[model samples]
Target: MSSENDWNEDLFDCTNDCGTCFYGFCCAPCLFGSNAEKISEKNCCLMCCLYLVLSGVYLCWVPHYFERQKLREKYKLKSNPSCGDCPTTLLCSPCALCQEAREISSRENVRRIDFNGDNNQPVVSQPEATSDEVNHVDMRV
Candidate 1:
């Protein structure tokens, strides 16, 4: 985690990744939906559609801001909902989206799955106990 001053990508540096910037600029909703999927770890298509619906009323930034806050918290960036997150996501939504896309795409990212464990134990099943091995009680009087 970097310091508050050290963001993964500068908000103004949209040219950092031309592909993502272009995609985000062309289709902000698609970019935001993809970013939501990665951040929330849920259905991408559904999120895309949801963003599309939200975009119609310009309410998409609400979720986008929350997701940005999550990323900031997860990555240990500055937590400035009023000063940073709000201004960034609202004032410069496209750049903000591009910044998020760049951050997610950055190699510093850790993959969701890691095979770090040494799976050396072999699979084996326990034998079932025989009925004779069970304790018997005589209660007949």
Candidate 2:
């Protein structure tokens, strides 16, 4: 029942992704930074610091709003008519962060913990076998 242009996950469907919801609830700025970095190759640490500082004055939503807009533009996702990015980010940043995190994770094909975890294991792909690698048996022997 959803369109291709819609977001992979809804803004309020935070519970749908428990990992992102829990991580975002614990440290929203970090999640925001991760989303920003993955969305447009921005610096995660710098963004996180900025978000932390702005959060004190209740303006953390500013960076998040811009990031959301960028994400929408990058993915061609549609915005709700009644509730747009500004209002959503200003009122419910946690949810927005979770939603963005989910989108980034899905689009980038990366895990949530990979954004902040140091012990990240690399995904090793198996090499394909070439024609010369196959062994041929003697049938006349």
Candidate 3:
């Protein structure tokens, strides 16, 4: 009589076991573990594709479990301490969700530099008078 939440918890546990899991993308532990054969194809297929893609990338490019762990740990350390306001904290750090949120906030704060006259400030340019022209003008004055 396990609920969907129970299944999700099992999936998270299995994914966390290897330290290189795709978060909740893999099959539930109840399905992929010792009792794997009893699980349904629908549940397995729903989770497998995303996990396979992530695992493939991790195995090919990342290669080192320790390296990935280090990256995850570093992000956790650097992430904002106040999780009360940020819903993305649930995803932890170095994750796509957290990175995307950070990128958006950063972009929002960035100021656009204006080189043309469109900005509110007045544009100032030096008068193109040569030194001789300035001297002659001064003498005439």
Candidate 4:
């Protein structure tokens, strides 16, 4: 088995994805619910309501901490020593949610296709190759 890996995104790297950062900051409960649902297939509405109720009483970070823990275990990610899960959720809830959202989205196999106006067809472009990468072809004569 391979060793555990660090989080795909850094906690302070919230600005990396503008949309997720905005969503996390603007509506934490919705983002938390979405992350919970994605991680455990839980009901988004129920999770959202739970987060809302918890936030009302000033215990909003509890669910996010648990969800973050779950995400770490599921992905075999290393734990943060400087800022633990509970503290991260408690102190930087929006950023934590943004990180989780970024992590989850990064793992999903989403592809973007562009439309060609000339032929009216969808074009799937390959990633640009780096200098170190070699294009191998088998020649049959």
Best by lDDT: 4
Residues 28-57 of candidate 3: C-alpha lDDT, one tens digit per residue: 222222111112123544333433455454
Ranking by lDDT: 4, 2, 1, 3
User: Model 3 off-target regions past 4 Å?
Assistant: 1-52, 55-78, 82-102, 105-111, 115-141
Candidate 2 residue-wise lDDT, 62-124, digit = tens: 989999999998878899788999999999999989998988778766343243256556545
Worst 10 residues of 4 by lDDT: 132-141
How high is the CA lDDT of each candidate model?
0.77, 0.86, 0.32, 0.87
Q: Root-mean-square deviation of each candidate, in angstroms?
A: 12.7, 10.1, 19.5, 12.2
> What lDDT score goes with residue 59 in model 2?
99
Give residue 41's lDDT in candidate 2 (0 to 100): 89
The lDDT, on a scale of 0 to 1, for candidate 3 is: 0.32
How many clashes show up per model?
0, 0, 0, 0
lDDT of 4: 0.87
Better lDDT candidate (2, 4): 4
lDDT of 1 by residue, 1-141 (tens): 456645667787887789999999999888988988887785778877877898899887887889898777667776545557887777788889999888877724444334435784444467976665553333232
**Every model's TM-score:** 0.68, 0.74, 0.19, 0.75
